[model samples]
Target: MSRFVRQSYYRHVYGQPSKREMCFDNIKVSASAWDTNLAAANPKFLSVNYQASGGGAFLVVPLTHTGKLPDLYPLCRAHTAPVLDTSFSPFSDTLIASSGEDGKIVLTHIDEDRLTAALRLEKPEVNDLEPVLRLSGHVRKAGHVKWHPVAENVLASTSLEVKIWDVEKAACVVELPQQPDMVGSMSFNWTGTLLATTCKDKKLRIYDLRSGELTSMADSHTGIKGSRVEWMGRLDRICTTGFSKFSDRQVFVWNSGDISKGPIKQLTIDTSSGTLMPFWSDNDILFLAGKGDGNVRYYEYEADELHYLTEYKSSEPQRGMCWLPRRALNTQDCEIARAYKVTNNLVEPISFIVPRKSDSFQADIYPPALSGKPALSSSDFFAGKTAEPILVSLDNLSETAAPPIKSSLYASTPVVPGSGAVSPALPPSEPPAPRSISRAPSPVSTKHDPLPSSSPAIEQPPVSHQPPPSSIVAPSVDAHPEQRSSSSSADVDQLTKENQELKDELAEKDCVIRNLELQLEKFKTNQMKIIELSKNSLN
Candidate 1:
């Protein structure tokens, strides 16, 4: 085999699975079949969705309480149905939220002292803990819940519609425009100002959170299975993972500033049946974990391409997985990131560690991380105040929080409360059915209004053409009135009609070209799959 050589700092990184004694075992994982991790983790606690009988419940296990948990233990139970998703508050170690099939979101504050006392007992009772706050607004079952990256007491949950909630007020502050299809996945940018979402309708949409306007959108993968999206940290980039028409897993990286022009780069992985869940690290590393596969593929994303580094292979496959926050990583061990993989009855921690001979902290691998502090309060955030997250150095444990690093990568554009930069009234068009499951091209179209002229431009030309000449220029003030008016109304109408026709032609061609590009990509992917299969057979 011929291979090109390249040097990378993370080229030799490896995953170290937790020992049996350290793993959380004997817990019933949720079987709701939702496209969620079924787990949420922080430095202090790990929350796992529990398969309860009477109501939806999740267990919050402290990091020190690792072992084979009892058959019945304390659970944060309040929901009337199975819990679909759970997320820990970024600013609070004891605060966690859960969304349930009963269309409710509950916030529970875990009492560490009570939990500690229970863990010390020889036989702990099955204690049922209730939530401190209950939010009921979604008409349909809520599928996902997430906390704002840079704001305190601000949360987001998705159902038929995505709602931004102000936890302090216990109310839904911003109800985003309804989604066309069920949202498969959504992610907030680093600044928490813009949100990127992938929907079942096979479209990737970006929304300005402040105004609740759909800014730009594009066609995504064609497979009917779920898709996932993630915003690259501190960069104006978004990455999505989904299945192609032929069931091959594919990854796409888009310029967050302009999605109308389509993905800047794309690549197809293997023909895996499981969805690839994407995770982004502060070091620009992208980790792809297959839903059903034990192996995790990690890459360094630079220069608009994903450079393959290595893969972590294991014998036991994972049902779901979640990454720990960057601030929680062990800098002494040169741990760049850590992921918790939930198997049938155990949740194991896998730490991605970089090999080093020295015991000192590796500054290159460990950058200043988010200090788990909110930059803006709920009121300030909704009042149009914007601020970046506070960062702290990993080298010093007790040092003061570092000042927020300012970067020119993304501007804090003030979101107008009621601006229609991109029309939110676009009809929800169904994606065209696949011609055949094998190798046929899927006719996917993005039915979104054109982005405002002030938006960033992509490499490709805009879909809509320039306005007619008459609209671009005004009649000279010194021109003779009769001469200026000499052009008959019929002639002006003819010019307008021609301009419209030309614009339509250009748009049609642009759509055709994009479809052709997609087809070509599919063909290439198919060829590569065949070659790989052949090589395996020969070997």
Candidate 2:
């Protein structure tokens, strides 16, 4: 008999879909043919691509405002064409960016107070929300917009080329080399140093943002449909979702260290016509929500293999889907992640929870999550400073502490702490190395340090017309020559520590390989027994 042991704490996690009255109804989701997620959400608001007659617009609803929406509600109408994609800033609840067919990106600031008041009215008056800033540079229709995970007020928009913008200064800081074809999706690594993009060319490209250089490009899924790429945090890998040559949905895991060699592992999901949108709940759990499908399948990535977890199925098909930030998760209910599914006229919230009897905080399931606070300013990041994300404790984050949504719509209200409430601190050990890119001959050099314990209080300049520097340079050393000896000794000690860490990782991998071999042997023994039994029965 084959004896298999399951050893994951999150293996029992299941999804709980919100009821009809709890979900936002009467939403006019966009009918655009663009293969993009039309919805984006944070702790405070949910922005959905709105279907309108003229010009592009998206509805920004307060999280608290649930149930049937008013017929004539306000919308963020800043684009003259149909909007393709929208992304909420990781560092701010009120700030969001939207890209449209107008070849422009609009940065909108949600007036929570004003929007809440309008939603409360029996006969809501018509009001058009305006954007705070507009970025116009892409000559073609911008299909996607993503905010930097670890930087404040920094956004990336994809058209013919990828443009990195400083939202505060209204400037394009870095424009990556143009893609061979239309970009389907883009994902930034943990430290915001490398960018992974999937294009219509059926290829994946990783860009080294520091030098504005193309790191590695590899053939991805071969199907004609769109593909999406996501950087798996801390794992030093990239997971891409697309279709196989036979049009079967497939997931590929590629080594970030060297993507040119191709994906390390590939698996075929069922033949679903809809594109699979991949989202990482944490570093381990991956949620795959297929557009036009009602089921969302999740998997746990471990030992270089994606272990199948469980699937959440619903009868209502989703046109688009978006995930809520980790900081906004309801820890009291053992909720691991939350995804908002956009149906025809409704936006539903699906909470992935781990069933637990205790009311205490589950620290094993909830590690330190990446806080909304940025690791470094845009200026400091561009100046060659590499830092890990500032992590925060989820222990104090309770359902009662969630952001107050004032609408009469639902039962339990969730709250998000203000940005100022975040503690700027780094973990004890150095986090995984920031994804570094390499050219043919020389590899990209990156200095890894746990992020600063405290955020710098420097303010960014209003205007920045200069293009991004060609290369990132380290900070200047002190002129005092007497400190050289001490610096050399410190470097030696750090190198020794890193070497030991590498050795420990290698040993752990070896142990995993042995365990897998033993399991394979047991499976073979079980197969033999079944074959012998069948032969005896035939005789």
Candidate-wise lDDT, in order: 0.78, 0.76
In angstroms, the error of model 2 at 465 is: 28
Model 2 lDDT tens row, 1-539: 65986688888889999998999998878899998888998888999998765588899999988999876677887888999999987777777889999898887777777688778888555545656556777889999999888767677999989988765445676788888777889999867878999999998999977667798899899998889999886557789999988999999998877889998889899998999999986637899999989999999876667889889998889899999888889989999999999988899999999999899988878866777777677656665666667777788742222222223211223121224233334222222222221211011011211222232211111221222353233567758656765766676676677766765674465445434644775698899999999999999
The 10-residue segment with the lowest total lDDT in model 1: 436-445
TM-score of each: 0.74, 0.74
Candidate 1, position 301, lDDT: 79
- Deviating ranges (above 4 Å) for candidate 1: 1-4, 397-539
For model 2, what is the error of residue 434's alpha carbon versus the real structure, in angstroms, after optimal superposition?
26
- Which residue pairs clash within candidate 1? none
Q: List, residue by residue over 1-539, the lDDT tens digit for candidate 1.
A: 65976767799999999999999998889888999998999989998998766678888889888889865467777788999999988888878889999888887778787677667778654444546556777778999999999878888999978888776555576777888877778999876878898889999999878778789989989998989999887777899999989999999988877788888888998998998999998787899999899999998877777989999999999999998988888888889999999998899999999999889888777777888877777767776666667677778744343333334222343222222121222332222221111211011112222223331210111343444565544645755676555554556777778868975675465445434644775698899999999999999
Per-prediction CA RMSD (Å): 24.1, 23.6
